[model samples]
Target: MTGARRDSCDVAVIGAGMAGMATALFAAERGLSCIQVGNPGGILFASGLLDLFGVHPVAERRLWRSPYAAIAALAREQSDHPLARIDASSIRTAFEIFVAALGAAGLRYAPLGDRNRSVLTSIGTIKTTFGVPLSMVAGVDALEARPPCLLVDFRGLREFNARQIAESLGHRWPDLRHRRIEFPGTEAAPELYAAHLARALESRQTRERTIALVKPLLGDALAVGFPAVLGLARASEVHAAFEAGLEMPVFEIPTMPTSVPGLRLLGALETAVSARGVRRRHQASVRALAFDREAGTAALDVEGVPGVERVVARAVVLATGRFTGRGLTADRGQVRESILGIPVLQPASREAWHQRDFLDPSGHAVNRAGLAIDDAWRPLDADGKPVWPRLFAVGSILAHQDWMRSKCGSGLAISTAWAAMEQVARQLRGTGAG
Candidate 1:
């Protein structure tokens, strides 16, 4: 499956993250032969919230428009193309569809609604919400006005800081009872955490032992909150069992750089794409793209494997992500596209790359460094002309937007992928590819 085949697809997408997956799914549903490549499991590094809009007090004053407007514009432009698609009435509606699809696969997203302002984090920060479990009214109601809360950290998870979280919020909610209980699994190597959890789930003794270790901390507590990766994939079952024994409201908080929800999403997407006959090859890094300008085809080289090539369809969707995903490149003083050598929009220097602090709301505004496109989401050359008639760009690859810090990563992927699919479908219809 890695080698070149005489087969043809209506659309071929690169990168398998949210954008790529959504694009492929939309294309396939429209009866297009779609081929998808790359690994999007990097979503695990994201906070599982579907930041459809940045409605939080801290986020509303930004230069961008509401998520609704952004998605509407994408859908409108995409509708001009040939694909069958759905227009989401609002950001919340789009999120509902996303959550529903996830739930059908046994993964659930409990919408907290849009009217809430206070969210309880596992580490104790009162974050605002657009609609995530931590920000739900139920989550807030579970706290019952900042009672004494016990925060637990696996000894080795250095990403979470109990002390910092406590200090940041404790000053405001002085009565917020905070305690850190470190579990023994912290002694294991960082890479071993997931493996250790799998082993624990398979072993009754380990599971019981872990429950026993944390049993003493939950004594008569009003509620309990911990990082999402609490060694539990069936959260409801685990929460039920814990409640049956401890009689406490247990909830999980979203953690960064590989949250549990993000992991679940990747798994769900893999299953969905595979079921639809889409072949997925992981770690099969594409070294170069061979474009037949006359034949209107592209051949991709599978690195480290000789005589292996994938001749994809004439139309390609470059959903490859930003710098971290290797879609964009940065050198001493220049930034450009890595694959296909497309020109990119970049800042003047490293100092202008980001703001000083990671938590600074303004840290991730490198929009100019992304792929430039017209209203149709097609990649534009330096002269602002469409580079390829059939090639479309979506997600983080587009310039002038920061999905992560702006809390719109998932939304951007979904809407832009939808738009790109519509465009491809239209083109295919015009060319009789389908």
Candidate 2:
């Protein structure tokens, strides 16, 4: 690896989770040159439902229809929570920009509004989330009206059971019906994968055949629901075709990851960032990150290449997620920040991390552990000072908020990315630098 290339940019975004992607998108949108590192495989696990503060008071699991109201409540009760710290206007702008970028990349979402929308899940559960992809939007209306709905599933797809959903909701929506048919070409296959079925549906033959199978079973149903196996590349087109062929409202029920919508999101984000001229190092990660205090710059040692390559930039945004993304590591004694070894704010000891009962209403204290950031979004040292002039932390890597319980994962990522990038832009210009 003698010829390892070194690159420079205005910003080097560490990690490629939702937050990192949002940060890169924002930075690039601002006309700042950005080099984004790390693979964003985690997006593949997303349900494609962008949740923006659906629940508050984790112990009670209180769901909110108005995300703005939930944010206000969170601001009052948990002032330090990341979502609580940002202004509502900034949050709205962030979501608008994020979803707009995705839409440009062919992953259209329902228009953002003041309240959260309820979307159906493959397990027959209703998830309250903010951004619903256009392919799944009709289900939102169908669910609310409780119309004569028909749910469809492929014969070999084991993950989605249309019958299970129909049975579970039997008492409430007796008009709901479910049927299964062999996917056009996967009839002989004993088991089917959603991604494969999705890719296959992109073909006109497959889409038409699948529609033909479901059209006969439409009965008097006003709308039809299917496990989300629409086309991978052209999902909206495929979904629209289904509605036109069946002459009914067609919606998709999100299944567990790795999901078709997740794939679309990942592809759309990549397309959006690439279109904005953001340089990406997919499947690579930041091995080491350091700042040159005198130069007013940060440097990264990127791994997963033939050899370590260097990336120098004016600023860096850490969007590495929590334990799941390996941004925060834990041991028997304590938790540690993985990439930069920044001090993590955590419980007194591992023993105090969890409650005696694993199912305690209150989430474990450990779940809320991560880097502490200044008001400006810079990661703070143990003495509560900025670790680096231009270093910023966003997403689940920030401390004092349990995104999972609060259902603000997407909001926290997108909104904070917008706010932090604003700070980055302002600080860079103030210093007469890019």
Winning candidate number (TM-score)? 2
* lDDT score, candidate 1: 0.61
Q: What C-alpha lDDT, on a 0 to 100 scale, does residue 357 get in candidate 2?
A: 97
Residue-by-residue lDDT tens digits, candidate 1, 1-434: 44364446777788888878877777776778877777774576655555564432223434223445544453454333111133554335545655655655555666535443345554556554444542123355654576656555565655555566657777665544445554445454553343245335334455466557667876555666655554434544554554455556655666655556567567666666676666565555667776677877766655422345464686888889888888887877767788887878777777787667756654544643688776666888778887877888887787766665445677677767877777888887888786
* lDDT winner: 2
lDDT of 2 by residue, 1-434 (tens): 24667999998999898999999999998999999998884798999999989888899999999999999999999999988899999999999999999999999999999999998889887889999998899999988899898999988899999999889888888998988888887768999999999988899998998887878888899999988988888998998888899887889888889999888999999999999999998878888888899999888888875567888999999998998888999878889899878999999988889989998877899999989999999988888899998999999999998888888889889989999999999989987866
All candidates: TM-score: 0.77, 0.98
The list of candidate 2 runs beyond 4 A from truth reads 1-3
Kindly give the stretch of ten consecutive residues in candidate 1 with the minimal lDDT sum.
Answer: 77-86
- Give the lDDT of residue 409 in candidate 1: 71
Pairs with backbone N, CA or C atoms under 3 Å apart (clashes), candidate 2 = none
